[model samples]
Target: MTARSWPQTAPDSKDWVRDAIEASGDLVYDWDLTADRIEWVGLASGFFGTGDELVPDSGRMLASHIHPEDLPQRLKALTEHFNQHAPYDCEYRLRLQSGEECWVHDRGAVKLGEGGDPERLIGTLRMINARKQHEARLERLASFDDLTGHFNKLRLRDSIDLCLKESYEANVTSAFLVIGVDNLSKVNNAFGYQAGDQVLIAIGQHLDHILRSSDTVGRIGADRFGVLLPRCSDIQMNRAAERILQAVREMSIPVDPARVHVTVSIGGLVFPNPEHMTAEDIVTRAETALRQAKRDGRDRFTLYQASQQQNLLHRRSQTIVTEVERAIAENRLCFAFQPVVDAVTHQPVSYECLIRLKSASGELVPAAAFVPVVEQLGLVRQMDRHVLELAAAELAIHPTVELAVNLSGLTAADPTWFRALKLLLQDRPEMARRLIFEITETTALQDVEETARFIQQLKDLGCRLSLDDFGAGYTSFRHLQALNFDIVKIDGSFIRNLRDNPEHQLFVRNLLGMADAFGLKTVAECVETGEDAGFLANEGVHYLQGYYFGRPSLERPWLAGSQPVATLPALKSGAKKAGAA
Candidate 1:
C-alpha cells in the first residue's frame, strides 16, 4: 500500500507519530498481510540496528531476533491473532544488536480489511528488562537465605513435601536430618556476632558442598540446618548424618589471630511407614532426635528409632513427673545453699539456693538428676516459686544472709511466677533486698523483651539480679545492654581450665572487662584450687564458688556463726584442680 492509499492523515502527521513513538520508548511495527511486507516506524531500528535491510516477511525477520526459547510461544500467539483477529499481549526475550538480550512486553490487535480478511497487524513493544530482573531477584530471595545461601524455611518445607510425595508414589524411603551448632552462642559471646555469622556461612557452604546432589540443605533455625534426602534408606541416612557431623567436627573457623572450632549435634528421621506421614511430622521427629543427641552429648548424630517411642527416656520423663508431683504433695522439696565467697576476703557474700528433692527415705536428690526432668514436665514455674518461698523464708530469719535463687527459663517466660515472687516479698521488704535471683544466659536470650521487663520488675522490688552461665549461651554485648544484671557468673566450662588454657583466660578476661565496664560484678564458678582462685583474684573476680570454696550443703555455713572461708578446708597441698582432676 502506498502512503496515499493509507488512512487519511494531515500533512506531517506521520512525522508526528514517529516522534511520539521514539519519545515514549516504544518500538512500533506494521505487518502487511496481503503484500507480505514489513515496516518499522520507531526505535525498532535503534534496538535491531539502523542499517539493517527490511525483509519482505515480518515473521522471518522477527524470528532471527526473537530468542529461540521464546520463538514458539510468540509464533503461537501470532498465529491465533492472524486467524481470529485476537488481541496480542505477550512477553518475550529479544536479542539486541550488541548480542545482549532484553525483555519486552508486546501488545496490539489486528486491523481488518473490508473483505473481513486480516490485512495488517500493528503492535507496541516496551522494554520490561528491569521488571523481569527485579522479579528474578525476588524469586531468589523468597527461596534462599541471604547470608548462608541455603534454602529458607518456606522453601525447605515445600521441597520436603514434594520429596515425600515423590517417595510415596515410588514406594521408596526419604530422610530428614537436622544439625545444630552446639556452641554458636559461646562463639558469639567470646568473639563478635559477625564471627558467628562467618561460622554459619562456612558451615552452610561446607554442607552444600559435601551433601549428595539429591539432598537439599536449608537453614532451619538460628543455629540449625535441615537436610532432605530423597530415595534414601536407613543405613544411607545414618551415614550421611555421620559424614556431615564428622566434617563439621574437624572444621577450624578463624575468628582473628586465634581459631575457634565447633561441633554439631545431628538428628535424622528415616521414613519407617510412609503412609499418613507429613513433612511436619518428619521434621518434628528429626528435631526430637537432635535434642536427644545434644542431651546425651553433643558432637554426635542420633537416628530417630521407632522403638524409642516406648523407651526408657519417655518412661523416665513420666516417672519424673510423678515423683515431682509426689514431692510437692509431701512437702519434700527443699533448698541447699552453695556459697559465693568474696574473692579476697573469702567470706560468703551470697548463698546460691539450689533446689533439692528429698525422697520418701530422706535421701536428697541432686538438681542435675531432676532439674531437667522438671523443666521438661512443664513444672519449672512451680519449682521456681517453691525455691522463692524457701529462699524468702531463710531470708526472713537471717536478715543479714543474702540468698541467690535459680530461676528457670520456663519461669522467666511466665508472668505469673513473677507475680508469685512479688507476693512472697511483699510483706518482707528487707528480705527482697537480700534476695538475688539468678537466670541462665540461655533463658534470658529466649525472650529478651519479656525477661528484660521481668528483670526490671525484680530490680524495682529491691532484689538484685545475677546472670548465671554468662559465657555459655549466645550472650552478646547486645544482651548486656538489653538487661542489666548485678553479677555475671563465668561459665564453669571456661573456668575449668582457666589457668591452663590461654583461650579460656582470654575469654574470661574479655568477659570481666565487659562486665566491669557495665558495672556488673564477676563471679568465677568451679574454682577448685588455690591456683585457680589466685588467678581469678588477680583478674578481679568479685566472688568465687566451687568445692574449693564449699559444696552445696543442706546446712548453711552462715547459720553456724562461722564465715565460709574459715570453716571450709583449704586446698590440699599438690592437689590438682577440680577441672584438672
Candidate 2:
C-alpha cells in the first residue's frame, strides 16, 4: 500500500492518531533538517500556550523558547543523533509564552534520506514538570539538611573531600571548622524541644549570613555544624570564626512567647598541607579544638595547634576505641563481680557487676582505663548492652545471687535499651527480681522525666533500681523524691574517710537521713578501712563496698570456695560494739 493511501484505507485513522497524541500529552514535530523548518502536530498551540500567530515554524524560532541553559543540551542531543545516528533523548526546561518554565522530555529518531545523510527528524515533547519537581525534591533531600536547608553531613563531607583534593593540587590552604551550640540541653530542658529546634534553625541562618559565599555550612550533628572554607589561610579562618561567634552571640531568636539567646564554640583547623589529611581527620582535629574551646569556656574560638601530648592522647584514645570495638566483637568483654556486703554482718548480699575488657594478652582492663574514651566516642550504648547481656546470663546461671549493673546516661535514655530489658525479662520474673540496675544521680537528672519512666519500667519488670553516686552531682532532694530507686549509694568521696573527716561524717549522716526519709536502702562505696566500715554499720548503712570488702573478681563469687569478701575486721569490731552496749 502507498503511504498516502494507507491512512484512507483505515477509517478514522487520523482521528485515532491525534487522540492518542493528545491523550499522552505529547507534542509531535517533523523537522526538515536542510531547510531548518518545523511542522508541529498534536496540541502544539495549547502546549506552548500560543496560537497560530506565534507558533514556532522553524528550529531557530523554537530555540528561542528553549531555556538558555537547556538549549545547549538540546543542540548536543540533536547533533549526536544527526552525526552518529543515535536516538535523540534529552530532558530540558522549556519557556512557555507566559514566561513560565516547565521541564520537557524530548525524544526523537533521525530519518535519513539517500546517501545516508540525515534529511528529516521526528520527535515527541512531553511536559515532565511534575516528575522533574519530584526529582528535584528528592535531590534536595539527598544533598541538603531538612531542618536548615544547608548541606547534609554526607554532602558536607564530600565537599570537604573535594576541597582537599583541589587544595592539594593547587598547593593552597583550606580550613574546616566545627561549631557546637552551647548549653542546648539546658534550653531543651527549660523551654521544650520545639524551642531548642528553633534555636538550632536560627543559629544555622546566622552562620549562613556570617560566612562568605565560598564557605559551605552543614548541620553535622544535632547541635553542631561544620563549615568548609576553600582558599582559606590561618588568618582567614581565625577571622571567619570570630565573625561567626560574634554574630551568634548578639542575636536573639524568637521562640513564640520566649526569646532565646544563643552562643557557639568554634574549633577550626587550617590545613596548609591538605594532601596528608582526610575529611575525617580534619573533622576530628577541628572537633578536638572545639572541645578545648568549650573547656576554656563557651562562646569562644580555638584553632587547632599540634602538641605532642595532645597527639599522644588522641592516638591513645583511638587505640583504645579500636581495641574496645575488637573486644566487643570477639566476646572479650566480661564482668568482674565486686561484693556489696551487709554493712553489719559483712555477709555478701549482692555484687555489683563491673565491666572489664580481657585483652589479647589476657590482662583484664578496668572500666576506668577505657570507659571514658568509649563514652566520648559514642560507643557506650553498645558497651552498656554488652554489659546487660553478661549480667543477664550470669543471673540465669546463679539463681540466688542478686547483681547490680551500672547504666550509662545515654543507655538510660535509650528506648531500645528498655525494649531489650523487656525482652530479656520476658517470662523470667525470678531473674528480674534478682536483677538490680544502677544509674548515677547525674544520669537520672540528664532527662528526669525519661529516667523516671525508665525506672518505673524496670520496677514494673520486677527489677530494683539504685541511684548510684548520690552526692556527686549535688542532686536535689526533689530529684531524689521523683526518681523511684530501691537503693541510694553514697558517693565514694564522702565515704572514703568517714572516721577521720568530720565534714564527711556530717555529709554522710545527712545523706543517710534523706535516704531514711525516702525509705531507701543505703550503700556506702569506698569503705576501705575497718574503722570507716564500723562507723557506716553503726550509722545504719545497709551495705558497704570497696577494696576493704573485696576487689572486683573475675571468679563467680557464688561458686563454691569463692571468697567474695575479705575477712571483715569490721564484723569483729561490730561484735565488740554490741558487747559494749
Candidate 3:
C-alpha cells in the first residue's frame, strides 16, 4: 500500500506551475538552469509574490524583473554567477495589468546538478507601486498652494530663480509687487473666517482685473498676493502697484458689509538691470515700502527706495498721487492725434486720438504714465467716458477725417456707454464714417466670443473697430483670424528700432504681409526717428506716430481741427477735486 502511494505531477511541471500562478491572477514564472530555459506567465508578475514557482532555477526569472536602468550590471553579475555555478540573483521592472507600470524587487538563487550543471532558478517579487505613488503625490502637494492654486512658499523659492534666469535670457527686467490686505485681520476678527475668504477671493479677482495675463500672481503667505511682472520697468511696476491698490478700494466684495471693509497696500521693487540684484534685496525693498504704507496709513501704494532715495520716497509718491488728481481735476488730460496711414495708401487714412497728462510743472506725460492708476482706481471707465465725449466733439470738427479713440475693457461694455455715445453723436451724422473705436487686444480677448458681439454691435451702430496693440499682451495673430478687426496696431516695441534691428524689421515685414492676408490694415506706433519712420513706411506701415510725428497733448485737440462734443476739461468741472491736497 505504501509503494502504491506516489504523487502525480504534470509532464511539463513548469508549465503547470505557471498556469496555476496565472489562474490565481498573479504574475508567474519558471526557470530551468539545466535546460537554459526561462519562462514567465501572466501580465502582472512580481518577485516576492510568486517566488515559489521560480525556485530551483530563479536567476533568469528574477533578472527579467530588474529595472532597465539597473538591469545591465545586474544581468552581468547574474551571468557571471551562472558561469561559475554560483547563486542566482537579479531585479528589474516588468510591465503589468493593461500596460500599467510597476517597480519590483526580485531575489533568488539557482540549484545545480551534482555534475555542476544548473538545474533550476527561483525567486520572489515584491510590488513597490503604492509607495512610489505616495511619494509622487507628496511632491505635488509640496509644490502647490491649496487656496489660490498658486505655487506654495517652498516652490516660490525655486520658481523665482528660474524666472530670473528666463527674464535675463529674454533681456527683460523683472519686477515684484508685494500686496498685503490691510483690513484682513480686522475682517477676520469683526466678521468671520468665511468673510475673510470672500474678501481674499475678491482681491484676487480685482488683481487679475489689473494685471497683464503674462504676469504671475501667487498667494505665498496668508492674506498676501505676490505678483511677478516680467519685461517691465520701474514706471510700469509702480503704476501696476497703484492699480492693484485702487482695485481693492473699488471692489464691492460681499463681506459682512457691516463688518470692516477690506483694503490692500501695495509696494513694488523693480529689479535693476545690468546687475540683476539678488532676490533677497528685491523682497527687502518691497517689504520695506509696504511697511511704510501701513505706517503712513493703510490702503495706499508706494515704490521701494534705497538709502539714497530719502524721505522723498514717500514725498515723491504723494506728489505723484496729488499730481494725478490735479490732472484729473483741472482737465489737464489732453489728446494728441497720430495719423494711421493705410499700408497701401502710405497716406493718412485716419488719426488715432491719444490722451496725455500735463504735469503742474508743464511737462507732458503719456497716458501710459497715468492710465494704469486710473484703471486701478476704477476711474478709467469714467476717464474713458470723458474721452469719448471729447472724441465725439472732435469728430464734429474734423467731420471728414476719421478719428479713432480707445476704450478700456470695462468701459466698452458699460450698458449706458452706447447711450452716451449716441448723445455725443447727436449733431454729427458724418462723424459715423469718420469714427473708429479702438480697444487693446487684451480687452478684445477678455471675452472673446462675448467681445465679438460687442464689437459687432459697435459696427451695427456704424462705428468701425480697430484692435489696438495687437501683440501687446494676449492678442495674437490667431485673434486676428478669429475676430473681426479693421485695423491692427503693431506693438511699438517692434517698431521702435525697425531700421537697426533686423529681427524687428523682419517682424514688421512679416506682420504687414500677414495683415494683408487677413485684409486688416496696419499702423506703426512709437515711431521716434526718421530712420524708424522711413523703415516702417517702407515695411508697409500705412501710418506712423511717435515723437517724430507728434507728442501727446491736451491742447492739441482732436485730429483735423475736429469740434469738441465735450472735453476732459468739461468733465472735470463737474467732479470734485481730490481732498489729498
Candidate 4:
C-alpha cells in the first residue's frame, strides 16, 4: 500500500485494497475527494477510446464509453458513490482504443476523514471481455468434430432445420443428403485408427474446398457426412454429389499412395414438393433414399422413389413381413441358375443363384425387385442360407454344375454366417470346388483387411472368389490389391455397348488386359447378341454371361439332357443367339 502521512486522513484498511486493485492488468481509477478531481491508470486512456487525448479530458470520454443501454444506470451508480461516499460496485461497457466494445468490471471504496468529510475514494476496473469471448469460442468448437472440424451431427440437424425453414419461407427447392465414405472400415483396419481419422479429415477439407460456403456440411456419423443444400434442384443436388464423389476418388491424402484412396456413396431427398410432401418429411425421406443407395451396392447415389420406398416400408408392415416369413417357411423362395460361360469354350463356368419369392397372389418377385426389401427387413441371411440348402438339394440332380450366390455385405460380416457357410461347405465336399462366391466391390472393400483374410480362408478351402462387377467402382484397383480374386467380371455397361460404342470396346479391352496382367480370369457380363459374343471373344474375355447365352433357369436348361424347349425363358437376343451355333 502507498504510505500516507501521520494525519491518517483516510481509513487505513482501504489502502492495501486500493494498492492490490491497481496491480491488476486493467486500469484502476480513484477520485481524491480532498482535491475535487478524478484520477485513473494511464492505460485508462486506451480503454476509453481516448488513446491520444489528454488524461484529464479522457474521463468524459470514458463516460461516453458506457453503452447507451447502461449509460443512465452507470451515471446513477457513479453519482451516488462520489456524492454520498457510498460503496461502489458496477460492471459497465468500455470502448477500447480500437473503438470495439468490451466489458469492464469495477469496484471501489469511499472513506471519510476524521472530520467526517469525504477525503478520498478508491476503485478498480479490469477487462473480463476476452474471457467471455473465449468461452463462446469453446462452445462453438464443441459443435464440430475435432479431427475434421466439420459441424457435428447436432449442428448438422440444426443446419438442415434452418435450411428447411428458409426454403419453406422462400418457396424454393432444397435438398438433404447423407454421404458415406466407402470402405472406411478397411482404412481403419489396414492402416490404423489414426489413418481413418486422416481420411475423414481429408474428405472434410475436400468437401469444404469443393462446396460453396452457403452449403452446410456436417459429420453425421462415423465415416458419414450430411449436407444441406438450399434452393437446389434435384439435378443440381445430383451433380454436386457426383462432384463430391469425384473429389474424394481423386483426392490423394498425404499418406502412402497405396493407402490413400477413398470414395463416397450419396443419397439425397428433395423437398417440400409443395404439391406432395411437407418440410418435416425431408430427413426421413433422405434416409429412405440412403438405404436404397446402400442396398444398390455402395458408391452410387439413389434419389427417393416413392413406390420403391413405400414397397420397402410396406414390407415393414405386419402383413408383408408375415408373407415373406411364410414364403421362406414353405420353400416358396425359388432359385434359378444363370450360366456364366467360358467365352472360348462356350460352356458353363459357373451359375449365379438368383432368388425369387412367390407373392401371396402367386406372382414371382424377382431378386432385383425385392432383394432390397429382404435386406432391409433382415431376411437376406435366412433367404441366403435357405437358397444354399436348396442349391444343395438341387446339386443332387446336377452334381458337376457350379453355383455362385449373392450375399449382402451385412450378411457376410455376420459371424454366424461364416460358421454356417463353413458347415455347409463341409457337408457338400463335392460342390465345394464348384462354388464361386460372388461379392460386389463395395462389400469386399468394407473391411479390406478382414474381408481379404476371409477370402483367403475360403481360397484355402479350394473355393473361388470373383469380384461381381469390378469396373463399376472407384476403388476396384484398391480391392484388387487387398484381395486375391480368381475372377473379376467387367461391369455389364461396357459389354452392353461393346458392339456399337468404340469407347466401350476400349473399356473392355483395358479391363480384360488388366485382368490378364493380374493373372486373373475375366468375365464379360451382359454380353448379348452374336455380335457381343464375337466382340468379347475377339478381345479374349475368359467368361461371357448374358441373356444371349441363357437366362437363369430353375432346371439349368442348357445343362439338362434332352431339355424341353418350352421350359426355357425367352432371351433378349432371340433364340438364335441362345443356341450354341
Tens-digit per-residue lDDT, 1-581, candidate 3: 45653236647776766677666544544577656665656534243334445432344544454446877866775677778755555444664434455665556676777887667766555566676677565455455545456654435544556677777777777788789888675776677767887777777767776799888776645677778887788788878877777776777767665534568888777765554344544555677888888899978887876664644443454455567677777888667665555434446666777776777787756665566545543356567777887787776665566888888765655546766887766665677767888887766775454467567667766778887775656555666766787878777777765677898777778778878888987777766777877777676666666556544434444345755443332122122111100
Task: Please identify which of the two predictions, 2 or 4, would achieve the higher TM-score against the true structure.
Answer: 2
Give the TM-score (vs. native) of candidate 4: 0.49
Estimate, for each residue in 70-143, the C-alpha lDDT of model 2 and write its tens digit: 88888888898888867799998878899999888999898888989988889888999999887687567556
Looking at candidate 2, the ten consecutive residues that score lowest on lDDT are: 572-581
lDDT for model 4 comes to: 0.70
Better of 3 and 4 by lDDT: 4
- In model 4, pairs of residues that clash are none
* Model 1 pairs in collision: none
TM-scores for every predicted model = 0.49, 0.55, 0.41, 0.49
Global lDDT of each model?
0.79, 0.83, 0.65, 0.70
lDDT at 561 for candidate 1? Answer: 73
* Candidates sorted by lDDT, best first: 2, 1, 4, 3
Off by over 4 Å in 3: 1-326, 342-347, 359-363, 529-531, 553-581
List ranges where model 1 is wrong by over 4 Å.
Answer: 1-306, 561-581
**What is the model-wide C-alpha lDDT for candidate 2?**
0.83
Which pairs of residues collide in candidate 2?
none
Query: Candidate 1 at residue 497, lDDT?
Result: 55
